[model samples]
Target: MSKNTLINILFLGSILFIMKLTIFPQESLGIGSDSGGINLVPFRTSGYIFLHETFIKFIINILGNIILFLPFGLFLTMRFKKINRLWKCIVFGSIFSISIEIVQLSIPNRWTDVDDVILNTLGTAIGYAIYKIIDKKKMYLQED
Candidate 1:
């Protein structure tokens, strides 16, 4: 298959994986049933998790949110050159993350938190940065 085609397949798969990870029930993931609440205040959930929760929980709740969206940003940047700007990546990431949070509001055991949105956006930014570095390196190599 062609490179762009392969990237498209990977991007679709990544999106599905993200849906399964975020939208599905948590029992299979071993987290048990979440209380199902909304946290609007930025850093509130993250701070609590950092200070009171187990290290694993902190990682899962904090870092996990960011890591979850990294591939999304990378794929988005790779697939659509129009999203070349960092601000575009941030906007797209925030919208996607916010959409997920909105979906979680209806799910039985999910917690909708602003912190997730923040971290996910950060992850997207990081992913875009990585893409730029990789693209630059490729350009440099071609010029050599």
Candidate 2:
């Protein structure tokens, strides 16, 4: 397959993985509830997790959100030249994250948190930085 086709496939798979983790419910996860939860204040959930929750839970809640969306920014930049700027990646990431949080509001036992959007956007920015660094290295090597 061509490079572009491969990237597209990978991106689609990543998106599905994200949806499964965020939207799909699994009873085994102990997340049973009749309705979802919402946290509008920034960092409230994260702060609570950090202060009261276990270290592992904190990592899963905070870092996982960011890592979960890193591929999104990378794939977007790779697939679309129009999203070449870091700010564009951040904006797109925020929109995507906000959409997911909004959807989570309807799913039982799921949570809608502003922190997730912040972390996810940070992840997008990190991904964009990684891409730019790699691209710069490639250009430098090619000129050598």
Candidate 3:
């Protein structure tokens, strides 16, 4: 297959992975009673960062959210050239995260955390930074 086809597969796969993790985690594990909610304030998840836990668990819970969205920004920018702009990427990332949260509101066993949105945005920003860095290098090499 072509490069664009491969990238589209990656993008679509990522979205499915995200939805499964965020919305269907409990049921995926054979558990029930999945109600969801919304958090208005930011940085609420920071408390988890300090909680005493195994290093792996701590990193997975706190850092996983950020890492989860990193590929989102990259793959999205790669697919949609118009989102190459940093602000556009950020706005799009925020909208995507918020829409997920909103959907969770009506679903069972899901959460709509503002902190997730914030950290997910951070991941997108970092991914965008990488994209810009690589793109700049490409321009520099072309000029040489």
Candidate 4:
């Protein structure tokens, strides 16, 4: 969109990136305690549906993760208009998530989860989709 919007997005993105990095610092040597190591816990859809605790946990986990990096995707798309394309947005988002994962793998007290990568990418994609929808609405209103 506009230069002012891009600038604002960049400013926000920088703040978010710094905050996230600070909260989840990278490992010192690319490996950390076994207790905090990455775990490939499969999301149990049945548990999500059947058990009250599992259902609440699943909802919380999904929503929390989705909300975390939403700003990253939003700012990325808003700053780089070229990222409006779905494939480009996804690629950049995936790379960004991967970088965060790699950093987490190195840091102590932080565990690198593949599920986080997936959820983060999904958040990015959802942000892009939201932007697209908003843009389209603006265009339609303008035309009308």
On lDDT, the leading prediction is 1
Error of 1 at 104 (Å): 1.0
- lDDT of candidate 3 over 1-144, digit per residue (tens): 999999899878777777776666555443235455567777555565556556775566667888888888888888888886889999988898888888777777667789888888888777788878888899999999
lDDT of 4 at 65: 62
lDDT of 2 by residue, 1-144 (tens): 999999899788768877887788756654434466888999998999899989888988777888888888788788788998988999988998899889888777788889989998998888788888888999999999
Return whichever of 3 and 4 wins on lDDT: 3
Which residue pairs of candidate 1 clash? none
Minimal lDDT window, size 10, model 3: 26-35
Give each prediction's root-mean-square deviation over alpha carbons: 1.3, 1.8, 3.0, 5.6
Per-residue lDDT of candidate 4, residues 1-144 (tens digit): 988777686748754763455345445522232346665564443244346556666775676667666767777787787776878878887787777777776666776676767777788788788878888999999998
Ranking the candidates on lDDT from highest down gives 1, 2, 3, 4
lDDT on C-alpha atoms for all candidate structures: 0.87, 0.84, 0.77, 0.68
Q: Sort by TM-score, best first.
A: 1, 2, 3, 4
Q: Over all chains combined, what TM-score does candidate 4 have? A: 0.72
Identify the candidate with maximal TM-score: 1
